[model samples]
Target: MSQTPLQEIELYAFASNSAQFHLTPHEFDVDLGGTVYVSTPIERNELALGAEAAKSALELKLPQTCDLVRHLLANALTGDTTAITLRIARRDPWGDTWWIAGTRWMGRVLGVEVADDGARVRCESAQVSLKRIGLRRLYSRTCSHVLYSAACGASPISASAIVSGSTGRSVDLDGGVPGSVSGGLAGGWLQTPEGARHMIVSETGSGVELLYPATIEPGTEVLLTAGCDHSTATCASRFGNLDNYGGFPAIPSKNPFSTGVF
Candidate 1:
């Protein structure tokens, strides 16, 4: 009896926030037990290894029209790398039979770029996080904790009525019904249900202007987050979470270290 030739195939899988995609450039569709890796125009370059002090990097290239490109752009632009996960696995096929060869690489996405009819994804190994410098205590007045972060513990997000209309960068929220408060969303964010986030540049009459051009449609439910100047007063009056304020409101205007007792 003749033995069937065995072939090895590499598979790529990307997942984030419940959306998962299995892809490969080797075959039309790869089936590993139950999960199928749909073939696509995906390819990756050789992993680059750097010195012990330098971080290793992996770059993946995909067509610009691929759906993965848009997903990558959204995640990268939103700075939500923690939600993105990638894994590369190997499998061997001998005729109709196949077996798993285990995972070859896995890590969080670092960044993405699109150009020349293609998109590139840059990823770093998990160990690279260990190279991060530890945060030192700050005595300055500004808050050290990031807003909405666990350390900050402030939830300013509020769902408003469906959008009434959009003109230029200004979007009419709550059908132009001015909430009881004015300038509630200034210097904050306007987020669409589809996860598109835009910065609120200025609060206009019954609407807020965005920093970017508006594509949001009428009747689209949106979320508005009140902004914070990271001051104790705003923390108390706005979010009503003064207990979690991270800024020092009593810092002396003049630096005592720079100005000695006269």
Candidate 2:
């Protein structure tokens, strides 16, 4: 296969918190024909949010910082690299939870390394504290994209079973193999041998269900892709919010029960 354009650049970051916040990015300049090197100046940011605020407020500041660094790297790098590494250097004296004085969060970029042909791209690590609540959610989104890029050749897994509406039944993949059983997105679920994995669609009740051949152990890395057809339909329907006027009951009176509380 032809090499991707972004197969050489590396990105890393370092962060510090001290009544102030700091973030720095180190770029790796590489000669595709040669080795990569860098000596970029570290970037920094300092801001203050009242100590009494909710942790969520503090958490919100992270994405903008991360985006800034991403944009910087995107502009700095010539093409997409095989892999980029980011390290968030954080120190919370009062713990990852308590945002007291001297509480600090630091971020820094280490650099990037190229992968060999046919080798998977390296996954970036975001070190977060156990006390940090929203970090996991952010990490999931970030890591998912990396995994998708690195595992491009993997096939989708066919679910072992399916549960839709009120009915549950066995499902068979037509000529599908074991590794082909990739997970489905939003409305799609994977069928395991143990039970069915269900994806929630909306508040009302619309989603996909997957029944697997066996119980999926915790921490098992299951690859799931959005079901193209189902996802398209769901999106086209605007998340199941399409108007079904025909199903609406006709009003018996212009003002039912003479009260406007219908």
Candidate 3:
């Protein structure tokens, strides 16, 4: 019997917040020739110590798009390399698989080199240690599901939810009804036409402030969806999404203190 030929290879790029990029095939490539490091000490001849951790690097050719550049720049500015998780997948005639060589390298863009022709951007990234991912809750969340990325099975949000606004760090939305949003939409985001979403820092009567100073073209149309603050009341009353709430609201805030030490 003939073996199934490898048909397709794909690379998945994610932003610092796990927001996936719907990039086309032409935008990137996955190099399978990268090295995987395992720290084994050489003591006796052909004898070695236990493995410490694995290290891998990925090189990507990202197209020069407005949204992609912003996402990369945000990583550069914040020194946040923990959020990126590159999953290389391979597809044979009958099956599809991931983690190309049995590992998922999660890391940030260490350096980005722009082509002189200004047509493409290239980046190099190193894998982050597994310990950090656990401590920061970067991948494995204690919550039930990932926010925004999970399948909520809800109907599509209407285009009417797309609010027009003046471009700036703080956008003033036109016809924004006061109290329309419950508990304010802090930690939410405003999405650009190019699929870039900036987190909302605060919401006022006129507008909302973005967590970063994003590039806003004049007369740019941005979309915003109200977000809950993850409080039990907000999840239950405001969104009726208590079942999906990621916080442990019932957990006691104060530690048990005794009047005297034993």
- Ranking of all predicted structures according to TM-score, beginning with the best and ending with the worst: 1, 3, 2
Candidate 1 global lDDT: 0.66
Count of backbone clashes, every candidate in sequence? 0, 42, 0
Candidate 3 at residue 96, lDDT?
43
Worst 10 residues of 2 by lDDT: 53-62
- Could you give candidate 1's per-residue lDDT for residues 30-101 as a string of tens digits? 777788877888777665443431245567888865767666655533334432333444433435644666
Per-residue CA lDDT of model 3 for 1-262, tens digit only, reads 9996545443444556533453324223333345321111111112122232225345555434445556664443334443444454564334442235333444555554444322233323343444344554322223333334343221212122334455556677665524555245675566678766566668767667765555565466676656544456755665566676565545654545744433
Q: Give the residue spans of candidate 1 off by over 4 A.
A: 1-30, 37-46, 49-55, 58-93, 96-104, 109-123, 131-146, 157-159, 166-217, 229-237, 240-243, 246-262
RMSD, each candidate, Å? 7.1, 19.2, 13.1
Tell me, by TM-score, which candidate is best: 1
Find the 10 residues in a row with the least total lDDT in model 3: 38-47
- For model 3, the stretches where C-alpha displacement exceeds 4 angstroms are 1-69, 72-145, 151-168, 177-183, 252-262
Indicate whether candidate 1 or candidate 3 has the larger TM-score: 1
lDDT of 2 by residue, 15-110 (tens): 222111223333434222232223344332333445321121111112212333333232222223322222223333444321112223332232
What's the TM-score of every candidate structure? Answer: 0.54, 0.18, 0.44
